[model samples]
Target: MQNNFIFFFYLLAFLLYIPTLILGTFLKPPTKKQISPPTPQSILARIKKGSKYTKQALEDFEKLFLNAQSCDQTLWLEIIKEFALSPSLEIKEITSLQEKLKQNNPNLQNEIALTISVAIKERK
Candidate 1:
C-alpha cells in the first residue's frame, strides 16, 4: 500500500512537469508584424502587367496564324477567349484578326466570331 501511494505521488509530479517541459513557464509568445493591404498604385501596376501579358499572348496567336509558330488547339482556344475578353483590344482589331484566322483556320475564326458576339451582347 505504501509503495503504491509513493508510485502515484511520483506519477502526479511527472504529469505536472510535462507542461513546463513542453513550454517553459518564463518564455514569452512571439510577436507578429502587421501586413499592409495593396495600394491603388500597386493595383494599377498589376493590371498593367496583366494587360502586357495578354498582349504578348495575342501576339503569339498572331504568330501561329501567320505560320511563324504553332501551338495546340486547347492553348489556341484559351488565347482566343482571353483576347476576346480583354478590354485593351478594340472590336475592329478583333474583326481584322477574325478575317486572318478565317484564312488560316475556320475553327479559330468561329471562336473569334463567338467572342465578338459576346462582347457586343455585353456592351448592349
Candidate 2:
C-alpha cells in the first residue's frame, strides 16, 4: 500500500509536468530566418550553368537523329518534342532553338508544331 501510494504520486506528477512543458513551448513566438539577397553575377552564373537534364537532352537529340539529320520531317518532330519536354531547358531556349532550326532547315519548322506538344499530350 505504501509503495502503491508513492508510485501513484510520482505518476500523477509526471503526467502533470508534460502538459506544462508543451504549453510553454506552444506559447513562444516563432523567429524569422534570414536569407542573403542574390547578386547579379551570381544570378547570371546560375543561369549560365544550365540544367544538366537539358544537356543530356541535347546529347540524346544528337544521337537519336545522328544518321537522320536531314531525313523525314515527322521523326525529327518527335525528337524535338522529347528535347522540349526535358527539365533541362527553359521555354525560351526551346522556342529560340525551334526558330533557329526553322530558319536553317525551313522544311522542319512546322514539323514539331506546338511549343510543349509532348507534355500537353502526356497530361491527358
Per-model CA lDDT versus the true structure: 0.60, 0.57
Q: Please list the residue runs of candidate 2 whose C-alpha ends up more than 4 Å from where it truly belongs after superposition.
A: 1-53, 59-69, 115-124
* TM-score of candidate 2 versus the correct structure, residues matched by position: 0.40
Q: What is the TM-score of each candidate against the true structure?
A: 0.45, 0.40
lDDT, candidate 2, equals 0.57
lDDT of 2 by residue, 13-74 (tens): 99999999999988987889887544333333443455654565464444444333545555
Per residue, candidate 1 scores C-alpha lDDT tens digits across 1-124 of 9999999999999999998877886687888989765433333343346666555555655654333135455544445555555677777876776677667765456665776578556744
